[model samples]
Target: MSGLLALLDDVAAIAKVAAASVDDIAAAAAKAGAKAAGVVIDDAAVTPKYVHGFEADRELPIIWRISLGSLKNKLIILLPGLLALDYFAPWVITPLLMLGGAYLCFEGAEKVVHAFAPHADHEIEEDFDTKDPAHLEEEKVAGAIKTDFILSAEIMTIALDTIDSPNFWMQAITLAVVGIFITVAVYGAVALIVKMDDVGLHIAATGRTSGGRALGRGLVLAMPKLMAFLSIVGTAAMLWVGGSIVLHGLEDTHLWAWPYETIKHIAETTAYAMPVAQGFVKWLVAAAIDGVFGLILGVLLIPVATRVIGPLWATMTGKKAGPDGHPG
Candidate 1:
């Protein structure tokens, strides 16, 4: 009986340790997810565009397909790649992050340029429209998954960087949690965004109360504006986050510190004047500066890419130039 009691005590102690480890993992995952917020926001913002122009019934289905692809991208592909990279080629992380950031900047800047130019890429938009619906859906889903892979890579790297886990198991657990949490948060928001119009239309058409109908009308009317707002916000976020990442990477790799430090100092100095609004002002200025830098870098890269990298890529892939005819 005494021996049985001792064994029970040991089991209880083991249970306590397991519980504590779980708590630690949860805490770490939350922190890591928070650290990847910029990338996550961009992910949520970018997804809704792929579902645009689809029939109402098809919208949710498209979103669901993309969401599943996103999960597979993160869990099955990216998770293992991250682990292997960490174990083998850890040195590539920062460079790959910078490359991803550059891509984000390029995308954001291309949108800005198109807005100003207006006639820049009508052919590409027309191509998107001309494709068979089924084929287009497949293409969009594939494109979205590809984009998600880049963002997910950034998020995972950021999460991994933020974790203070000492052991491989702990790091793996935290990353897994972070990946699942972020995928849900991003795709859940995308689903809501995609379905808001349908929900509004249904409510407006069959609501029992006048207020419900009015709310539905408001949702339907507001959705277009909301989508516009999301596009603008997403572009800004991509530039801000991308430029920030590049700046920080440069600083980390010891190439340039003055640009980052200078921006921080100026933002802080500007914010000092506003006691209550200091944090907001600082953040705004920092983002603005980073966005501007991103825009400039992207603009510079465009011609170079077109003249050099684009042709090289086309040649390597044995595809004709101007196949997509898009800036991407």
Candidate 2:
């Protein structure tokens, strides 16, 4: 009887420990997901473009395929690789993260330039290459998946850097949670963005009340502007976050201190000026500074990439630069 009681107590204690571990994982995953927000936002923003011009019925399927691809990218591929890095070469994370940040900066800067100076659209080239809808869909999905892999690599790596778990299994579980959450959040948003027009049209046509119809019509009209806004916001996020990462990485490496320190000082001063919402104001100031720096660096990279890297890549791959001034 005493032995049975002791066994019961032991089981209860184990349950408590398991529950605590679960809570820890949830907390860690949330924190890590938050850290990867900038990349996630860009992922969501970029994915919708892949479904553009597809029939309404086909949009969800494309998003589904891409979401699956993103999951595979994060979970099956990058997860193990990152875990190996964490175990063997933890020092390498900062440099790889900074490399990702530089690429983000370059991408953001290119978009800023393209926004000011619109060129021949990539869609046009894509359209020219594939006349069949099914083939085009396949190509777009494939391209989007490829892009997702890169973005997912960045996201997962950033998340891994943020994870504080000492246990390997705990870290793995948290990363898996982050990966699943990100895939759902990003692609779910994309699905909504892509389907918004159809949804609006349905509501507009089928709504019993005039107000409902009006709301639906408004939604339909607003989608294009919304998409444009998302693109702009995503680009800004990429620049700001990318620049911040690079600065932080440099700071970590004991390379560049002034940029981050100066940015912090400026942000603090700005925060001090605004007594209310001081935290928010400071963060905004820092982000803006980082964004500006990213834009500058990204702009500088554009010419170098185009004049040198693009041509070298083309020569090596036997491919030409795409309409977006990038080697495909």
Candidate 3:
């Protein structure tokens, strides 16, 4: 009887430990996910574009395919690769993260430039003109997956950097949790965003009540504006996050310290001026500074990307170079 009682106590203790571990993992996953918010938001915002012209029935399927691809990119590819890096070549992580940050800056800058100048995307037009719907779908999905791979790599790296666990299994489990949660959250939001119009139309057409119908119509009318808002938000997020990453990386590498320190000093000064909302004011100031820095860096990178790296990539891929040095 005493032995049985001891065994019961032992089991209870184990259960408690397991529960604590689960809680730790959940907290870590949430923190890591939050750290990758910029990439995640951009992922959600960008995904719907791939399904834009597809039949309503096809939209969900396309999103599902892309979601699956994103999951594979994060879990199967990035997770393991990052783990290996953390274990063996940990020093490389910061530089790689900075590279990802630079890419984000370039992408955000490109969007800003495109928005202002609005050049024709002849390649996209050509694809639509040449390909059948099924083939086009395949190509879009492929392109989306390729883009997702880059974003997922950044997400996983950011998550890995955020995780504080020393245990290999804990880190692995937390990363997996972060990846799965993000993939589900992003694609789930995308699914809803893409189908909102249909849902609104259905409600508008079929609702028995006037209020329901009005709500439906409102949703239908709101989707385009919502998408536009999301794009703007995503672009801003990319720049802010990218600039913050680069600044932090520079500090870590001891390559430069003034930019980050200056921002911190200014943020603190602003926060002190608004003691009632110090935290919020500090964060806002810091983000604004980072964003402005990101915009400038991105603008600088655009010419380098278009003129040099684009042509080099075109050459390596054996694709004909466009006038802008991108693959034609």
Candidate 4:
């Protein structure tokens, strides 16, 4: 009986330790996920366009497909790569992060250029849209997934950087949790955003009461505007997050210091100017500066990316296999 009690006590102790670890991971994931909020928002915002013109019936399915792809991106490709980086060459992460930030800046700047360009829709986007419906759906899903991979890389890296785990297993588990949480949050919100008009329509058509119908009508009217708003916010967020990442990376790598220190000084000065709302004011100023920096970098990159990088990529990849090259 005594021996059995001792074994039971040992098991219980192990269980307690396991439970504590789980709790710790959960807490860490949440904190780390918060650190990647800008990327997360951008991911959600960028996704809806993928299913924009699809039939209502196809929207959710397309989102599900992309969600699965995002899952694969985070779990299969990025997670392992991140783990390997942390274990073997931890120093590389900052540079890779800065590279991602540059890409984000480039993307954000391109969108800004496209917004003002004579052609409202880019040539590539137009080509994708003109394809047959089935093909279009496939292409859009593939494009979304590929895009998700980049944003996901940023999110995971940010999350990893924020975590203060003591060892490998804890970091891995925290990252896995963060990946799953962010994916579900991002894609789930996207699914809802894309389908909201249909839901509103259904409600308008079938509501039992006048109030319900009015609300449905309001939703129907509001969705397009909401999507437009999300797009603008998403772009702004991408620039801000990207710029912030690059600044931090440059500072961390000892390549650049003036911008970081300057931004910090400005934020602090602004905080002093408005001590009542110092925290909020400082953050706002800092983010705005970061965004401006990102816009400049992005603008600079636009020519380089289009003139040099695009051709180089096309040459390396052979005929520019479209978005993983799965028939569409």
> All candidates' lDDT scores?
0.83, 0.90, 0.90, 0.88
What is the C-alpha lDDT profile of model 4 across 1-328, one tens digit per residue? Answer: 9999999999999999999999999899999998899999889999998887778889899999999999999999999999899889999888988999998898888888778773434544744855589988888888888889999999999888888986899999899999999999998899888888888999999999999999899999999899989988999998999999999998889898889999999999989988498999999999999999999999999878866776677787664522212111
54 Cα displacement, candidate 1 (Å): 2.0
- State the local distance difference test value for candidate 3: 0.90
For residues 207-268, could you state the per-residue lDDT of candidate 2 as single tens digits? 99999999999999999999999999999999998899999998889998888899999999
* Error in Å for residue 224 of model 4: 0.9
Tens digits of per-residue lDDT for model 1, 229-322: 8888888888888898888889888889889999999999999988788999999999899999999987877776667777887778875444
Residue range with the least summed lDDT across 10 consecutive positions in model 2: 122-131
Candidate scoring better on lDDT of 1 and 4: 4
User: TM-scores of all models?
Assistant: 0.91, 0.96, 0.96, 0.93
Q: What pairs collide in candidate 1?
A: none
Candidate 3 lDDT, 19-129, residue by residue in tens: 999999999999999999988988888888888888999999999999999999988999999999999999999999999998888788778988998778775456443
Query: Clash number for every model?
Result: 0, 0, 0, 0
Please identify model 3 stretches exceeding 4 Å from their true place.
127-130, 321-328
Superior candidate under lDDT, 1 versus 2:
2
- Cα error of candidate 2 at position 264, Å: 1.0
Deviation (Å) of 134 in candidate 2: 1.4
